[model samples]
Target chain A: MTRDAIILAAIAGAGLLTVLLFAAGADGAPRAIAALLFLLIGPGLACVRLLRLDDPLTELALAVAVSLALETIVATALLATGSWSAGAALAALVAITLAAVAAGFARARGAGSPRA
Target chain B: MAAGVPGPARESAGQAVSSSPGPAALAMAWPVGRAPSWLLTLAPLLAALALWLAAIPAIDPDQMTDLGLIAVLPPAFYLALGLLILGFCALLGRERAGDWEPGAYIAAWIVILHGTPAIVYGSLRYAWAWKHVGIVDYIQRTGGIDPAIGYLPIYHNWPGFFGAAALLTEAAGLADALPLATWSPPFFELLFAAALLLVLRAVTGDRRLAWLGVWFFTLTNWVGQDYFSPQAITYALYLAAIGLCLWAFPARMPLAASPVGRVVIRGALLRRLAADFDRRAEWAGAASSALPDLSTVQRRGLLAMTLALLASIAVSHQLTPIVTILALFALVLLGQCRAWGLPLVMLLFTAGWMATGASSFAAEGIREVLSTLGRANENIDSNLIDASLFTPGFRIVSNAARALTAGVGLLATLGWLRRFHDGYLDLPLTLLWLAPVALLGMSSYGGEILFRVYFFALPAMAFFLAALFAPRSWRRGAASLIVVALASVVLAAGFLVAYYGHERSNYFRPGEIAAADYLARNAPAGSLIVEGSPNYPSRYHRYEQFVYVPLVAWPRGNVEASANAYSLADIEQMMADRHYAAAYLIITESQKVEMSVPGLASLEAIQGEIEASGDFAVLFRNDAATIYGLAGRQGAEP
Candidate 1:
């Protein structure tokens, strides 16, 4: 139950913070943090979690590597398909990040015995 | 153990140990015990983080040994590294945190250690990034390619990295890639760590060894290739490819004696080589029995995914694709795997891209690369001897870099000899280590091929160096782990003696940036833009709007634009030329920094010389930089 709450809260917090970053006309520090979270870390962790490696370090490393490659792949695909407007690119990344996180949560839950 | 098995069988988790020496022998390596408290172990790490964060605010870029030299990053910077080393050893002192624990812990330490210099000194260090950012800006605005650019025109050919950055910057609502450039060294260094760890884990099959390898790499890397450039991205991709190959394929060659009849070669040398290969092939076949059991479909999937990665690498950088090709070929030649198709595929992608897309560099025929071979000795000499010509203080720093290189070279050699005696040097991976050295013969790369060679060989070199601490047996105890930490910290200390020691040239003052920004706003399209030299962040945004010409392309052989001894008459003559647009000259902090070195002309002297002649007027001037307009040009008055 505690684990589930933490996960849910984290998801909510990150999502809310991202929205705030976009909506609040916030410029410097908050925006930089958001970039780190949304652009690099959160999505990276999400991908890493899905790999299901016994070694968390390997998974984390692999995830970071995958995240970079994913960026290149997603950006390339979008550019190849069209002009790749800012909105479209953001949407694609957000969707990918959210989906990966969701999938990772599911995998983590399945791996663990649910108490609640 | 067949740990590389796909998801279904991977749950077995390394239980299928075959011919890996007996457990009786391996059991002696580590003491059986619970790990020490995480909180207690990590206290030093916490302290190190605090030291780093505090050091950032305390840093005054001007206070270095020489002005702006990295030696002045504050005492806390070095303290943080020392704390990391001690903290990490404490973390590994107990044996309970699982295989990834040390990996995770060391990774954090890497972040702190590598990130400090970048943070303390703001903006990207390499002037090359300014040009790179400029190229991306051009691509963003033009939405098309123009391979006619004078410098690094090949970057125009492979536009994937720039195109990706363009999209990200636009989507993220950032001004430009400057932020990315400033933050990239630490970020990319971390990524390189991950990639190195992955590759080490795949090859060594021992997590402790892998962790040690990652630590060694973090300590020894001074090449500064971790800048915001395609090479950094390409390097990570190359590592991933090697890692993935080792993971999926797992090196299972056919036995030389049983299945295939030896084809008789006519020549004596050929026969001897074939016989030697046969014996190694037999040993490799025995080793192959330990490989993972992958379904053909899964193998195919891995192959396809890996090929896509290769294609991406080929599309991104100029030299990495060729290195990837050589490394892949080396893997096969060492009887590590039978992925003969991989090198061929990479070659095709590399050649096709160069021939059709990278035609700017490729216009002279592949002969350009081929002709440059057999000059490795010259490249090395110039790189080591000539490039070290800097200020006295900075020379001490540069020599420390050479010392660090020599030290690591010694450690790796000792490790190799030790592992070779034990008959466990990991030949396929060693081949990967040797393969990038082939690049040394290919290009001088402006007398920096030695640095490039060191960068290329770094990942593989780290793995070998790790063996010095790695036990003959796989199991590791607190004692061995302590030694490993000591090795990393010692090497890291050596690295610190010089790594950011060139901070003077690397740091860009806000004044320089502001001057560049002024030119960006004021310079007309196709204006003949001249600089003190090709350094600092000037054409970053309006890269396409100007024709860049530099005052000094020194170091003996660069084409001089002014055509005279850097004189006022030369400046007047250049300004008088009826080119498409008028000429403007910029002098930034970089040129001022470069003046401390031998060959680069003194920017201060140039400023006085031009002002004394009254042939040029200050169109723009700032605290750290200045822009000059030729006094007698048409409409020259700003």
Candidate 2:
């Protein structure tokens, strides 16, 4: 698989695993690590992969920064609106991640190459 | 633009076309010619890690003198640090050294430098870090923010970091944010390295210079702002935003095309002094051609990401957004960046946030903040605690920190001049390096504005510091490598003393933590907790439940008043107030160490006086701490 394909696959897998773990009411290192990886990189990778930044370090750095910013905005808005719920926040983030991933895939397909 | 070479200096040295090691590789043939470059780097890193782990338990914090942790740290720790520095220098001088090797070396350097204190110190190091953790705890417990809270209202007003931390802590199923606070130094230092790489790569293709810059940043960043706080996160975002702007947004138009550009170009001496490379006729073609090859959609996406990072910084920190605004304006003014609208957007975000979320804090402090404007000397004086009050060992440590800062400044000046003389218009880096100085005239920030200025300028300063090692000729490559290595070792020595020397007061004991925890669990809401000083871990739980009053006051630029002597009568008078339902006085070893200055009554003397008065009884006592309350108050009994 190309690097793009591998990253997309990891995101999808991690996203699914995080949701399942949350549903199962798991509360330990496994659940925490999975949630951390998903939150820190899944949405960011889905967003930044569209930019086509090839450098690993820059990509990783931007991904983390974007991810943290997204989390802050989502959490802040929820708290400010008086509708705070960790599960709801996580669900909203996961929804955003999936939406971005779908958009990335659609853009790649529209370019007439699945590998692009 | 430089064809992926490191610098124009390397180009002048006749090795611009190749990435091979120069004469320096042959100089090491007698010792380790047969070893692979990765092994050469990783072996020392691993050995250092092993040695450092072994050395941590050997360190006894009680043995630490005024020189801080350096006095108590085993010699093995020093050996480990030396090995890492020498190994990185070797890797940098080797034949066909890849990014992974030197990157790993620098990573190991941070792990050793920042991680040692993290692992050895059983609890969090700084009092401020514990206070931040309390903010996170508040958010998690309340599930909301109280911007007008009596305690830590400023944090509540700008609670982005605390809110995000709360979400992560709950998601991770952690009970508290203490672990995050414990490992924050290394985590933030690593984040800084990544962000700095983006900034450096955007400026120069020289991998050697970029890596060395990161290394130098790690060694010289003795400012201690990397504790688990909003500053750490916002600073990372600040660097990332600048790096993204520089890498992707070079100004597209020539200097003569714009009005400001035309005015700058019309002045001969001003043009030479600015020396903006894009304005040069010869470099104009390459500068325009070197812009990142991204589609319009991608560029817009990147721009959105940059704005998001900026918005994050705006909401999270009070000072970084201003620094970001100044830096972006500098970049645009020098024609180094094309994002002319970025500073304006940043201004909007800052002003909007202040008008809304942070308005409470701004409203209360606006007058005081305005009064400090243009008071540069007073602002700078706030950052300097009274050096005369320090013990002899700490005085040396303080001087070493000053010397290190001065050395970096001196070397950076030389490096800037050399780059300018070589026909390289390094005006962007120079402007960025000087941009944070603007804040020195803005506010004293509780005597920390000067340190914050140093922290923000360090990335640019580290770049110039690395420029000193960019060899002028291949024949000097070996000599350059040696000089770089020696410089790093000397800085690392100073860094140890400057960064770790204050562990005597910074490091908290388990007994001290226990006393604080006891007070946290037992103290009633609206009770009064009299503290010896604000330098110990005081507010990690139920912090808002009680009022905290420190005996030693730290007013603006009043070091003498900060060491005021407190008597038993004064305490009785203060605690006897009928307004508070109950009151207790707590003293700890860390507070004693911190308040050991002249003119301050020792915590022990106060304890003895209280014990003799027979009006207050000891609620709790440990080797490292004691908590006392009025003899007749039922709430005082623990």
Candidate 3:
């Protein structure tokens, strides 16, 4: 594959992974493994992608996404532990999702593109 | 430079890269000749003066004189002192080119100067309320009022001092009292605008950009609403410190003068060495020889100015520590001081003098700080995390949409940062500029109180964004679109949220004016009252001046354990002991509602006693508040 294709594929994969991790955690089917998967997959993939991205906008987006995902996952886990309520968990999920998607769009628009 | 390519080729290349207009284009596109400079400066002040004058018909002249003196004097004195200091600075640096345009600077100064009254007023109101709201409760619990008002009273209750001083100075002379508190909102707003201009000027070294910053800070609805609070006063001080630090200690230049000459010379040289030892002193002997000695009066004037600035920080403690922290960080980042000795010494001095009171005050709120921090962390965690790689289609789409919206603000901020750097603005200074964004995002308080703290940061934020998006070329249509887009988002989020969600809420407005008017008109002669709601009492009446009880029983007689709650019982006892006529209970929608406390049943038991007493009557009830008056209570005539 060409470099552009490779970059696009990576972006797609990262985006897909983010969605999957969130979906799994939100399902609340298996507590431990789902939480573990969320901790490892959602933020971990975003972090790795952010560090590896060559483009500034892409990197910023990934960073924001990772931050949001981490916040959501921890909040959900805490809620499941009875530290927080379900309403709070839902609000966190919504806010995080919003922040992540916004970051992604900003990145795609090349808002913080690194100047040569 | 290469010879110009074919026009179409160049044009196509530009179009290919990006369609958006740059910062230069945006600056030029704004209407330049909107309001005359003098009119802009005097408009708010004159309006406030007019309002005060208008109030004279309603208020006694003695009260008016006291209010006018208290509200107007400090700010006027401060502005005059500021001018004198500026003049002295100019005398000291005669050789320096008058690089700054007088018109722009004066315009900016006028905008800032007009805000002094507003800052003083809001701060005074907040401070007075802080002391008065729960005073009766303290009297009940501690057997006397805490003279300190919980924290450093000097800085916190500055308005009271102004008011008292004014009254004392006038010796009960009847003069028309201006509604100084009412004027506070617009005055500080003007200052917030001026500070933005100063920041932009410091960053871009362009008067036009400075003007743009002013326009953006003032004209933008989101920023304008935020500036109308005591927080603006703190912000103005922080910006002033930034300006002073920037002007006093600029970037170090290579010195043409010998090391001896550089050492002998002070001011900028000391700052450069303090900032970065590696910096070469670039003083030309010709310039040095041409400079004249500043007069003793001028030197004294400079000293006075410095003292006054330091005193201003002491007078307002809310943002002083934050300002100090930012200044320290900027100085450290600039690599001015090789050793930590000077910083340590300065820190010691501040801690001993200016910051000591603030440190103690913040310390008192340590429990609150910790709880707030914990809640903030929980909020961040819950709101930011998600589990699935893919969500329900609608959920996924919505999340993406919201994220995109949030990203616009972030992008605007980032874009501003880039432009600030490009304009040769200092990086450390920019970090200080960005401090408010972080503060706003981090603060756990979900009210105007937190927003007030965040207000100081808006000037920097607006100026940075304005400078950041300024068009580099004449073609500004595209840039104007971007500005509109970003501004709309900011307005929708900041102003709409504040207005619709918070300001309109019963908790914020609380119908203070109406409540005050009600008590003034209807309450019987010499009525003894206890205001049930802490928020209500703080808003409507001065608790310190009166003997009002601040506690009340709810529908089922639920008792609140807060300090204000205890005041109700104290007021009842005081009424019985002092042979007062009746008790007045002022309840707002926010206060009458049930909260999440478990041990409220005991407090509820008191409702039977309150109702059983034949003395009480439901005196007033409206959508905003319900006032209960004990029957046969004689109200005091004001």
lDDT winner: 2
Ranking by lDDT: 2, 1, 3
Model 1 ranges off by over 4 Å: A1-55, A73-116, B1-36, B67-70, B149-151, B254-301, B338-340, B367-390, B444-447, B471-486, B556-565, B578-580, B632-638
Residue B372 displacement (Å), model 2: 11
Interface RMSD of each: 5.2, 2.1, 25.8
**DockQ ranking, best first:** 2, 1, 3
| Candidate 1 CA-lDDT value | 0.64
lDDT of 3 by residue, B503-571 (tens): 111122235436655774555544655654433424223333334544643322112223344534554
lDDT of 2 at B71: 90
Candidate 3 wrongly placed segments (more than 4 Å): A1-116, B1-178, B219-230, B252-307, B332-350, B353-409, B420-425, B434-456, B475-501, B505-529, B537-542, B545-582, B588-615, B618-626, B631-638
Clash list (residue pairs), candidate 2: B6-B206, B68-B501
lDDT of 2 by residue, B1-638 (tens): 44432334442123323222322343355476566645544777788888888888998877888888889888898888887877777666554566777778778888887887788877888887888899888877777888788767767777778877877777767789898788888988988998898887777656677788888999999878788888888988899899889888865455455446766676777566444554332232243232357667777888998998898887787777889999998878656688889989999998888888888778867545333321222113322667786678867887887888788888888887776555455556677899999988786555556566787899999988888765654334666777887899899888888888777888899999999998888887778888887778888887888877777654342321232437777888767776776889999998888767555557778778888999998888898999999888766766
Q: Is candidate 1 or candidate 2 better by lDDT?
A: 2
Instruction: Choose 1 or 2, whichever is better by DockQ.
Output: 2
Against the true structure, candidate 3 has what lDDT?
0.37
How do the residues B174-226 of candidate 1 rate in per-residue lDDT, one tens digit apiece? 77877777777777887888877767766654555567788788888876677
Best by TM-score: 2
lDDT by residue (A1-116, candidate 3, tens digit) is 54433544454444344345444544333432333233223332333332223434223322322332344233323322334332343334334434444444445556443221
